[model samples]
Target: MRFGSIRVRLTAWYLMMLALGLGVFGVGSWFAMRASVFHAIEEELADRIRDVKTFLQDQTPFRSKIDIRDELSEHSVLGLGGDLFQICDEQGGWLYRSSALESGLVPIRLPSQVGDQPVYENLTVRGAPVRFATARVVIEGHPYTIQVAEPLEEFYEALERFGLMLWISVPLLLIGAGLGGYLISRRALKPVDLITTAAESISINNLADRLEVPKTSDELQRLSETLNRMLSRLDISVQKMSQLTADASHELRAPVSLIRTTAELAVHEARTNTEYHGDMMQILAEAERTSRLIDSLLLLARADAGEGGLQHELTDVSTSIREAMEQGWSLAAGKRIELTANLNSNPIVVRGDGEALRRLSFILIENAIKYTPEGGRVHVRLEGSHAVVTIEVTDSGIGIVESDQPHIFDRFWRADKVRSRSIGGAGLGLSIARWIVDQHHGSIEVQSQPGQGSTFTVKIPLAEIPAPLGQP
Candidate 1:
């Protein structure tokens, strides 16, 4: 595996863990084995001391005072094989020394008091490991201290072999674990590599293709699913953006072509005043339409960029609605539609941009009048309660169908394309109105059915009423 790769890191971590576990196991085993070996040696030494005590006690009955050196020499064969033995009096002077300890004195200390428990120690004797035990006994009413020691050469040899085996096996185990772990990690991440390649190959033109979903329920599978979801959303957004661009181009081309053609026709010849005035008027009207369309587009763009500049202040929503109604009367009168308002006399105040609220009301009223046939009726109402204010604009117009109602607020979408085209709208009024309401933390709902009529209701929270002067 390459350095710093996941496979290598996994293998390295596995090896580290294995090494730690093996080291703990080896240390524990070594300590356990040493304890068992020493325990066995201790048992043997205790038994030998007991035998020596029994021999000494037997000799005590035969003689009131026995020679320690001679007695130990006669029964020295009864002691531990290839071991050292010594006897000392209470005064700390050696009474007897066996042949094994005669050549070099293996210093042994007796306990201050006699006890049933024997004292044990480990020492080095003649460059070899040894275990020593000291015990106290009473013989013929005389206190005697006995010292017994055994060589540990074979024990040391076994431990050394164990240590050597552990040293040799641990590295091999670590190497095997590393290789196994690398293989497992590589196998697990193989899907990740495939996902990366597939994702890299996908582009805007082929956003419809999705990554393969893995069957196993794991993080990798979830990642694949999440990425596919993101891709789907991006694809939808891109398609919407493309459609918006095409519609914008088509809409802009009309007014621009009209303006150019009208200007060209007016200057192409010395026309009469009436003709010139009509052409100029037509050009001006198209220019105003183009400008309004551009402004609406820019506003939507700003809203999309999260730069919706809304002023937060106390706004009298009823007044704005009345103003929009007054403006709508002219347009309605031109179309011979009945325009009316049912605004509450009490002020319905909200915290939002007054201009934006007026624009929102205008957009809804204009949309109502534009779609309404001649002699149709349009009504605007503003009502307020303790918590929220409601604005409803009802129109007797070509209502939207159930299927098309959901998309009416989408940019550049129209329920009746041919009628909308003849009606001279850029199909952005409802979208802009929706954005305005959203900025004011409000909701707009549409209730419509084909050939019936439409009611657009807007709800915004009511602002706090100011307090009256206090008598206190």
Candidate 2:
């Protein structure tokens, strides 16, 4: 039982207890039956002895020992089955014997020193088992002994039957007990087995499994709920990481492509001062774009790695717009496009980093100038209110598709692929512009349709008013 598992141990203990009870009951019953049988036989023997002694005292004066022996023999034959009686002298010599035993079946070597010292014994006499008791007597100034012997077959038969019953019933009880123990153990462990099965069915990649728990509000049910919650968090975090990776790759593609194209074009050139200057400028332009793209990517990486957002100050929207127009003037004029600025007269201030806000405005104006056809108009406006300030760039150009407008702020996104290729710059303007604006608690949006010029609006909270207008 100790060597096996819990079920086996429990079964063994129960069976052993049953076996012990049966053994004790069988032994007790055997002894009880033997005692009862011996007590009844001895009681009968004692009664008969009293009767025979009384008759002997009442005998006539002419009665002899032989006559008395004949009388005892007759009584012994009448009281048959398991009793025997005999009369003997004090010197241990027999005078009369019962008819229950033949001459060769009597016990030999009777006790000589008998004075009520429990002269009773069980022994096989000649070929049969017997229980004998002896007592001393004095008659006519001489000593004599009386012995009583009983056959043991009745007692032996009763004990033997009890033992047989015990042997038969014990095995059957053990079988029943074994089956009962197995059923109980299985019922008790059913919950554990179910939990194990649930765990085994779940996959690491698809960790959407759940236990079929009972509504008892048990520990097992709580465990299942906790595991499900953990899986939900894991799925969310994995999705976010996947999105970040995809966005980074998309953002990196444009600059890499621009650098590749510029290098290729510079290499496939002939010697001429103007051509060489153009090639060098093109290469420098692409190099600077690549460098700025890389810088923006690094900033995003830092933010994702728990770094804080951009450093900010109270900056004027008009100043940023005017600077952006100046920088983008050449590009706008190169396409014969008209650039107009409707900036506020007062110092219209918003909370932002000056350099970042200026870059954002430049990106928007550049987009407007690049897409507008000859003689097209591009309007840049800066407006301020107590709540927020807005820098808006509106262009008369090959406008964005409504479908493409939704993704215009995405990294490396180009509304018109062929136009973007001819422009010779990475299509990261709107993406970086949006990033910078977002860092300053600002929002950028696009409103456009196919062949209907686009407008880019940027709004930021007026966290602090600008100082009185000052020249840069």
For each candidate in turn, the TM-score is: 0.87, 0.46
Candidate 2 local lDDT, 1-472, one digit each (tens):
3346656676678778877887788778777877888787677655555555455555524578788677666655676222477766655566677655547466534435566433567868666677776665555555556666777777777778877877887778778877887678666556667777876886656665555665547775777677667777766666655665776576567667766776677678555788778777877776776677677667656655656356677777778777888998898888889898998789877777777788889989988888888889999988877688888899988898777777887655676667676675446677678778778787899887557698998988887544577843
lDDT against the true structure, per candidate, is: 0.86, 0.71
Question: Which candidate has the top score in lDDT?
Answer: 1
lDDT (Cα, tens digit) per residue for candidate 1, span 1-472 = 4886777887888888889999999888988988899899999999888887887778767653347467677667654322488877777677778887877558656535656567888888778878888898888777888888888899989988988888899889888888888888999988888899999999999999999988779999999999999999989988877887788899999989999998998889889999999998988888888899999998987887789888999989988888888888899999999998888998878999888999999999999999888999999988898689999999999888889888989998887778786677888999999999999888999998767789999999988767778933
User: What TM-score would candidate 1 get against the native?
Assistant: 0.87
TM match of model 2 to true structure:
0.46
Highest TM-score: which candidate?
Answer: 1
